[model samples]
Target: MNDADKKRLLREMIFYRRFEDRTFEAYMERKIGGFLHLYSGQEAVATGVLEKAVVGQGNKNDYVITGYRDHVHALKTGAPAKEVMAELYGKETGSSRGRGGSMHIFDPTQNFMGGYALVGQPFPLAAGLAMGCKHKKTNQIAICFLGDGANNQGTFHETMNMAKIWNLPVLFVCENNGYAIGTHIDRSTAVRDQYKRVAAYDMEASQHDGMDIDIVMEAAEKAIDFVRSGKGPYFLEFMTYRFRGHSMSDAKSYRTREEELEWEKRDPINIYSKRLIDAGLITQDDIKAMEREIDENMENEIIKFAEESPEPRVEDLTKYVLDDNPDPRWIGPLQK
Candidate 1:
């Protein structure tokens, strides 16, 4: 990558870090509601992969979907920070018009379908989207992001089988953060190696260090290339970590502080910043100025946008509950 590309990647990683940091603070201060999941430690995985997949590197028509830890993905997909923050705040100006809250951020224009709150739900949805692209004869592919825990779901296995049999254009990315809520992967899953599980379907699968952006970008480019070439589906497992608790209400008694600190030492932002400095792509002063600008933008602009945004009215509570135009045969008894 060129110096400009490196700088852009750095800026994006830093923006996500700051955005997630500020979001946690906002949640604590009661500025945001719903079950909040901060993508603090896993920034590099999303940044490296999405930056290469969506931004300039890959096809613009590609679809991106993920589980509830979706703020970073939404931002990387070109969603405005102010509107995303407003969504978390449950305001009328949110991406989902304040109804979906933090879990269900959807913007079809940007090709970010929606963040599924249910574990492993995106697996089938992604396959279905890929089928649409295949039927339409479009070069578009669907990138499905899920947690390691979700891999154990029956839907995940079913989708994998379908993708392999039908040769769907989908990339299944498992963000293996070591733990699924309070239960560790060992306790919950029979097979710890997620990538190995794909061998049964004869699909291409590999694992990479999620903390390194360059590594992620490389893997993502290869995976995307293969899928787009109509070689069927591919699976990638990112060995990443999540610094924060599963949710805002997590007591965090499951993991040790020492383990957390050890992972903190390998923080993606710090690692990438150091690489940029050592490679002469960026200076300490440059990084400081970039951080300062991001802080100002978040505090002065984005936060205010969410704060001043109007709340959704009670009368319109059921507005998006059902379809705007329903088929007569499909209409339910309640509607009749």
Candidate 2:
């Protein structure tokens, strides 16, 4: 990518990082609710690929599907910050009708299928989407992002095999953050390099440094081109780290303070921001202004979503529970 593009991505990543950091504070103050998964240290993978420079609207189409660690992806995909925050706050104005909560943010307009909470659940769904694209004679492909621990699930293997045999246009990204909800990668798997495991299915696989935005963008561009050229599936293993705990309640006993600090030194947002400054593409004052703009916009969104929306009425609890058919009208009269 060019210098301007790089600076744009650096800004986006920083915005996402700061937004999530504020989200944690909001969660504590009861402004935001539910399980909030901070994409903290793994910002580059999402920002680098999703930036308008690397991936754009074209005949070489693309789609992104991933696990529940999804706020960054949602933001990068063009979902409005206010809409996402409102969704988390369970407001009617949320992207998911204030119904899906934290794990099910879906915006078809942005092509982000809902985030899946079940381990490895979205992989097969992603593969099927790619298969449909091939059948429809379309060039579009789907990108599936998952964690290292998700590789252990049987669904992961099944999806890989099907994707390869069918020659489905899909890119499987494994964010190898070293730990899965507390367990490290070495202890969790026999083959530590998870990308190599794709060899069993004869799929193309490679690795990239998830922290370096440029490297991640390069790898994404290459894989995206290869898939668009009718090459079957490709797997990219990004070695990254999450600065926050797995969830709001994590004790973080699996790693040390030194380890956390060491990773912090390689923080994607800071590293990329510094790179932009060093390259003379952006200034500290510009960054300050950007941060101020994002903070003010997000704060107003939170307040609006909260004050203007109502909690899901108790009688409407079963309104969206069905799959085949859903009843729009309330099942019974309002209790209150």
Candidate 3:
């Protein structure tokens, strides 16, 4: 890649890392409520994949959806940091108007479908979106992000079958962070290599180092290109780790401190920063400047926006709860 592209990627990765760190701090301070999931150690996966999937020329029509650990993805997919932070703060100015909380951020303008809380729900939803694009004869594709544990869901296999048979344009990304909540991948999954499972449906599939942004970008570009060319679905397994617990409340007793430290040694941001400096693409001063900029934005801009934003009023609680005009047949007894 060119120096410009490398610098752009580095800047974005750093922004996401800093943003996540600040978010965790906010959660700890009880500024943001509900279950909080931090995308701390797995920055490279989202940064690399999204750099190709959602940005630049020829990517305007793409759609993105992911599992609940979604703050970083929402931001990278073009949702403003202020709006995302507001969403976490349960402010009415949030992406979902404070209704979805941390997990269910949606911004249709950016074509970020949502951050679904259900384990593997995004799989079929992504396939449906792809099918819509196919029927409309648009080159648009859907990128579905799921966790390693979600791979075990029945919806995963069902979506794979439907996507292959119908030749839907979709990319199924499994961010395998080793553990699913308290359970490890070895114990939860029958086949350790998640990508190999895609072979059952005869779809294109591969694995890549999720810790390296460049490798992920390379793999993602190939997979996205194949899918956009109307070659059906592609499966990508990103082997990564989460530095924090599954959620803010997790004790993480299942893993050892040694294992955690070992992965920390391979910190994606530190490694990529070192690589950039060594290659003369960026200097220490450049890194420091970027860090300072991100910190200022988080403190002066994003947090203040959220804190000053209004909360949804109780009287208007049912406003966005249901559709304004729905088919009477589809409306259940509860609505009636």
Overall local distance difference test of candidate 3: 0.89
Over the stretch 134-168, how does candidate 2's per-residue lDDT look in tens digits?
89877778888889989999999999999999899
lDDT of 3 by residue, 185-282 (tens): 99998888999999999999999899988899899999999999988899999999999999999999999999999999988998899999999888
RMSD of each: 2.6, 4.7, 2.8
Can you give the lDDT of residue 66 in candidate 3? 92
TM-score of 2: 0.90
Off by over 4 Å in 3: 56-59, 325-336
Error of 1 at 275 (Å): 0.6
Per-residue lDDT of candidate 1, residues 53-93 (tens digit): 76423236478899998998887876778889999999999
TM-score against truth, every candidate? 0.95, 0.90, 0.94
Which stretch of 10 consecutive residues in model 2 shows the poorest summed lDDT?
52-61
